[model samples]
Structure formats: C-alpha cells, structure tokens
Target: MTETARPAYKRVLLKISGEALMGDQGYGLHPPTVQRIAKEIKIVQAMGVEICMVIGGGNIFRGLAGSAQGMERTTADYMGMLATVMNALAMQSALEGVGVFTRVISAIRMDEVAEPYIRRRAVRHLEKGRVCIFAAGTGNPYFTTDTAATLRASEMSCQAIFMGKNGVDGVYDKDPKTNPDAKRYDAVSFDEVLRKNLRVMDASAIALARDNKLPIIVFSLDEPGGFRGILSGQGTYTTVSG
Candidate 1:
C-alpha cells in the first residue's frame, strides 16, 4: 500500500462534546481542561488552518437529562441550549488567553455578551483567521449541537468536521465502555453507520453531513495535543464519508 501524508484542510469545523470540558470532578467546566484544549487548537491555528467550533452543553445540562426528570421538553431544551452558550464563552476566554483570536456567536441573540449567529459573519471570521465559536444549539429546541456542527460546517464551507470525543477513540460496534470486546472501525460509510445504529451523532446530524458530502473525523479529545495531531494526520481517528 502506498503511504502518503494527508494534507491539512483549509478550513474545518471542530465539534467538541461538553463532557470533554468536565475534568476529573465529572461536572461543569474545568479550567485546565479548557486550557489544554485551547493550547492544542493554538498549534493548529499556527499551521494556517481556519477553524470554527461548536461545544455541547452536556457538562452543564443535557435536554435528555432534564426531560427524563419530568421537566417540559421545550424548557429543558432551552436550558440545555443556554448551557452551551456558557460553554462557548468559557472556550472563547480560554482561546483568547492564549492569543488566539476568537468570536463567540450564539444562535440566540444576547447583544451584550455575544454576536447573533449569522452565516456571513461567521464565514468572514474564518476567512480572516479568527476562530468562531458557535453556541446555543441552532437556537431551537429538539436539536443537538451535533446538528449545529453540520450546519456550521456547510455554512462556512468547511472541508470536514472533526468530532473531538472523550475516552473512546471512535465509533464502535457497541458501547466500548460496556463491551471491552467491541470492534472499532477505522473507516466507514455514513449509510453503514446509520444502518447499524452507531451512536456517534444523532440521525439528523449524520443525514445533513451525508447530504452535503462532508467527511466527519472522530478522534480522542482527552489526549493531549490530539487535535493538532489529527490535523497533521498523526492521530488515531475514524473517518466517515461517502
């Protein structure tokens, strides 16, 4: 087999699960976790790659968690969305602390805190090498940040979506945590993922990616410097495309 190093993508969407922001305590934002993530991103930024980010709110509140406890679905979802905004702000501050230019754009408008989500403005930010942090989960209930990642990727014309996962490296035939013998796939088609009910992202997010012909790369976020390694084609990851 001929081996050739993969080229760095010109622009990319980075989807970070909220659980990643939770450190050893297993709750809320961990400053060190955010700082480490930001540092990895700084390495990629220095490589001349444009980036856009979407951070989930699982660390603070997940709609499913709230709904399962008897809360109204819409209210729970909104709270979950707000939680993502909080995560975005935390990330923005961390990135800026390292001298990386970043802008937090929210699906829900809060003029005092962040810019309202506008596809044009976001694209402009990326073109200028300014990282854009998308928050608030599409500004609508019943939508996960996974879906928002796909939307932003398409909107910004990103070459691929990088899913920064915690613990597990990639999608598996079964829950890796529960089944130690679960088979891991290095590469797979989106259709196969849906056919087998893989829990990488929700169906809506997967469908959007498939429709747009965007490749999704899943990798470990907990690994120090893993984000930069993925961009440099030296990290463990799974690619889903075509």
Candidate 2:
C-alpha cells in the first residue's frame, strides 16, 4: 500500500507473545526473528501509525508454568515480569537497529534497565513517533501480559489492539491445530468470545477489552507483511469487538 492510502486506524497497540521472538528455537530470543518483527513495526510506523507494544514472556518464563513446577506463585510471577523486560530490551535494540525510535517502559520501577511506565510520557512518545514497548505486565502478580496490553491500549486511547499470533491466523471455533475442520471467524463479538471460551485471549483480558469497548484484531505474524496488510485493510484477520 502507498503512503497516500490512509490506514484504518491511527494509533494501535500490538501484543506479540515472547514465543514469537523464539523462531525455531525452543527458547530465548532469535535475533533474526526479532529483527523481522521489528521491520514489520517499522513499516507500519512509516505509515504514520502511532504504536504501543506489549510482549509476553512465555519464551523465557511463564508465571503459571513456574508455579506449576512448585515455585512460589508471586515469585514466579515477578520472574515472569522480569522476563518481559528482557524481551522488551531485545525488541528495543532491534527496533533501534532498524532506525525506528523505540522506548522500553516497564510497569515496575527499574530505572537502571527501563524507563518506568508513565501514561502521559508514554503517550508523548507515541505522539513523537516513538514506539512505546510496555514491559513487566502491570507490575503485579497473577496478571497476564494480555491484560497489560488491554489496559495500556485503553490508557493510550488506541483505536484497537493488534494481536500477532505465531502460527494461528485468527480466532477459530475450535483448536485449528488439532481439528481438521475448524472455522475461523472474520468478526466476532467480545461477549461471544468470552461465552464460548475461545482462546483469542485469556478471560480477564477479553473481559477488560469488552468492558472498555476496545477492538482486537488477531492476525498471523508468520505471514509476510501481514501486520501492515491488516492495517491497510488487505489482509485476513479476526476482529473481536462489541
């Protein structure tokens, strides 16, 4: 799409899982994968879209998984939050390497590592064409990064949240990986998503987005130019809204 073709939304929050940065590796950040996604963000940003990002830390450590392994719940969660900060730093480096101004803002107070998340400051970054990467998952235990994305999206007054999945293209009636005949919904209501218990996002995240009337666009990060194409209204994605 050309620069003359205006995007569907002005400002958007992108929520990508840390696993998306892992590439074929079982764990840790893959430089090439992070660079690829960072380039994608750069493309969209070039179109004058103010961007906010919240990356999950599942590739490093999952709070629930750590807790399941007998670790203390709060400690596991704090570790998970730290993992997100690492991912955010990696992403910041990649984005900067690609000439995109980016900031890693953490919900937790870690001045040595990342700038503490301040709502107005974050908004100012976006207004200045700097991509704001929110880290640390709300700085609290038991809250998923999904919820953080929703909360930040709302606070930033983003038009929608773009959720980039690794392999899955969009939300489905069943597990497409396991079911041969799963159907993908082009558009779905937030209430329906919660009522059916679909995995588009966790229940808390979905409910938060629902209550605030924020739309989520789920698309495939595996697709080349998929994020940009979706914003340009030329890609297949699932829209979850009221």
Candidate 3:
C-alpha cells in the first residue's frame, strides 16, 4: 500500500453527534448521509482496523433540552437513551446495506431490538471485524453520550477516539462557524482543552481519555473520504493527547 493509503490505527472508536446524520434537515435521520458515513466506516474496516461507534442523540432528542423545557431530568435522559438506540438501528441498517457487518448494542435492556451491552461480546464482535455501535448513553441519567463514548472506548481498549464533527474540520479556539477568524489547532493537550474550554468533547470525557492516555482526533464528518484519509495520515484534523 502507498503511504497515503496506510492507516495509522489498529482499532478505534468513532464518536459522532446524531446531528451529523441529519444532513440539511432540522432533525431525524437523513438516509443518504447515514449511508455516506457507513461507507466511510467501511473504508477503514477494509484496512483491517477494529471499529466501535457511539452516536449522540441530539438530532432526535436531548435530555438536557427536554429538561430545559420542564420535563423531569431522569425521565428525559432515559428518553434520550432510547433516541440513541434509534440512531444506532439506523446506522446498523446503513452499514449492513454497505455490506459491512455491524452490531447495535444498547446499554439499556431492550433485547427485542438490540443486544444488551456486554463488554466481552462487544469486544469479540470487533475482533471478528464487525463494527460495534454502542447506544443508550451508558444506561443512566445525568451522563452525556460523550461520557458514554469515553467509557465504552476505554472498556473496548480502543487506540483512539475519532470525534467526527459536522461543519468545522477540527477543534478551534473559538466557534469556527460564528467566527471567521477562528483558529484551528493542529494538536492540543487535554489540559489545554479544559483550560480553554474548547469544545472537543465534554469535560468528563476529556478527563477520562486523558487519564487513560488515549488520543482523540477531531475531524469533519462532512468531508468525503475524510475519516479514511485521517487514518491514512493524510487529513486536516486536530489530535488531542498528552
């Protein structure tokens, strides 16, 4: 393989917001976009890398948003968890459509639709070259999907967590969409992300990754071939480490 086609990781966990699946729509899954992401995952898997995925449910429901509108926090959070399961199923269909084997594992017990989250089974699925999509936000309230992604990545022993974003390509000092002068970092330390309050991931997730010494690569999901390109060491992205 050429240098540009060589992937840098043996295994990784991809974390994306449900908003990423919505495309230009205000909310809900956009089938074309979902298929596009699945194809990206397929490219990486073709390179022989184990894959785990965690997709946020912000497009369909957000517990914090529900709470802000006067719903009970825990109930809203559980509702949000269910939303993630929906997203997971959508992604599973897309991945399967592309001929990439996938498993939708839920943290909540919903055996009819998805398999319950079991670390060993999930790891075994990855070992067998199937993509594992973790859903249901750690099966608890008060914790964001970011935390769930970090927790799952740690448990799966992923080499890195790829934070697939929409719009902007990498972590910036300011909101790039709002500020034309926003500067994107080539690399940033986890401490700097916390001290600067940069929006790489949640504080808890960042802390967990830092504690475990796992690197995070922040990149745009909208860029065609972007995820695979990054793994091949040929993309514009910010690496968070040390």
Candidate 4:
C-alpha cells in the first residue's frame, strides 16, 4: 500500500480557548472536550507536523473581565496565567492518556509540575515529534494569549498559527452572530484585518504575524474533525497572510 501524504505544514502553533475545553457546561474543564482536542492534535502529529499549543484561560479567568469588576489588574492577569496553566495540564493529561508523547512548558517556573519555558528546548521537543503545550501568557501582565501564540509561533518558527475559535467559521467583515449581512472572507491580508479592525485576534497579535510573515488560519473548533481537515487544506476557514 502507498504511504499517506503528510500535511503541508511541517510545524504549527495551535491556539485554543479555555472555553473549548468546557463542552456544554459553559465553565471549567469538560473531559470529553479535552479528549476531542487531544485526538485532533494526535492526527496532526501523525501527519509529521510538529505541534505546539497555547490554550487561553478565558473560561476560567479572563483578566480584563476581572479588572472591569474592580480587581487589581496585575493580580488578575497573574490569576489568568495560572488558569492557563491548569488548562494546559488538563490537556496534557488527556493527550498522554492516548499514548501521545507531550510536554507542558510554563512561562512561570513550576519545576515540580512542568518544564520552565526554554525556547531551544521547546524547538527540540517539536523536532523530536513531541507536542509542546505552552502555558502562561508571556509570563507577565498586560498581554493576552493571542500575543503569546504569535510570540511562540515566531520563536518556534512554525509555518502557521491555527486559531480555533468557538463559533463562526472564519473572520468576517462583521460579527456573523450579530449581523446577517456579514461577509465571510476566505483569504485576507494582515493589513486589511487591521484596517477593518477585525477581531480575529488582538491588534498586537495581528501586527506580530504581519511583521514575521506568519499566516493565521481561523476556523471553528466546534466543527467535528475540522482541525485535521484544516491541516489537510480541506476545511472551511479563513487564511490571513502577509
């Protein structure tokens, strides 16, 4: 039998929201959600694509939301980072349970629980076909995981960053949920995203991608098997390129 073809991208950075791990509960880690994400990543790994994931903590703790409610900004941000760490561990357990080799690397030092963030070591892990889950956002305050995703993607030299949004298939001219007249874009330039003020990702994240010439693929994570399909270029998604 002929060998199956590998994915086009040799390395990729997947950015998932904490809510994606919540399933139907709308809060906290849901077992089935984590397992499904793990399965998708496993499929990409099998296709020879080195995967590094940066999962958000929005479901557990959104720093901005807390700050809006009268909490200290830095403290809230740190809590958000910790929330991401928890999500990362949950994902790690799910991935390892299926016999997929993985590592959890945290920006903040948590030696007993995970490896501290080391750029070289992260790249090494990917080269060895081990999935690396990056937790903690830039290890500091005033930054979102979206920025961290771009930073990690640039550092890891990933060919593209896969943005797994909860709903809505891709970036649209307007909020599809709010406007029926919203137009979906198949492909777009980073400049246009900024010009149009699209919220596919934060401005900082989009700027970084533009500067480094990294493409961002926006797709709905809720779609069954969509992640694997995107890597194979068979999914409904928007490609933002330089």
lDDT of each prediction vs. the true structure? Answer: 0.91, 0.95, 0.94, 0.93
Scored by lDDT, model 4 comes in at: 0.93
Best of the candidates, TM-score: 2
TM-score of model 2 vs. true structure: 0.99
Model 1 clash pairs? none
Give lDDT for model 3.
0.94
Question: lDDT by residue for model 2 over 1-242, one digit each (tens)?
Answer: 87777899999999999999999999999999999999999999998899999999999999999999999999999999999999999999999999999999999999998999899999999999999999999999999999999999999999999999988999999999999899999999999998999998899999999999999999999999999998888988999999
Candidate ranking under TM-score, highest first, comes to 2, 3, 4, 1
How many clashes in candidate 3?
0
Give Cα distance to truth, residue 196, candidate 3, Å: 0.7
What tens-digit string does per-residue lDDT give for candidate 1 at 1-242? Answer: 01243447989999998988988778998999899999988878887789999999999999989999999999999999999999999999999999999999999999999999988888899888899999998999999899999998998999999998889888889999999899889999999999999988999999999999999999988887777777777778889998
TM-score of 3: 0.98
Per-residue alpha-carbon lDDT of model 3 for 125-213, expressed as tens digits? 99999999999989999999999999999999999999999988999999989899999999999999999999988899999999999
Which pairs of residues have clashing backbones in candidate 2? none
User: Between the candidate structures 3 and 4, which one is better when assessed by lDDT?
Assistant: 3
Q: Candidate 1 — which residues are off by over 4 angstroms? A: 1-7
Per-residue lDDT of candidate 4, residues 144-201 (tens digit): 9999999999999999999999887999999999899999999999999999999889
Which residue pairs collide, candidate 4?
none
Q: Which scores better on TM-score, 2 or 4?
A: 2
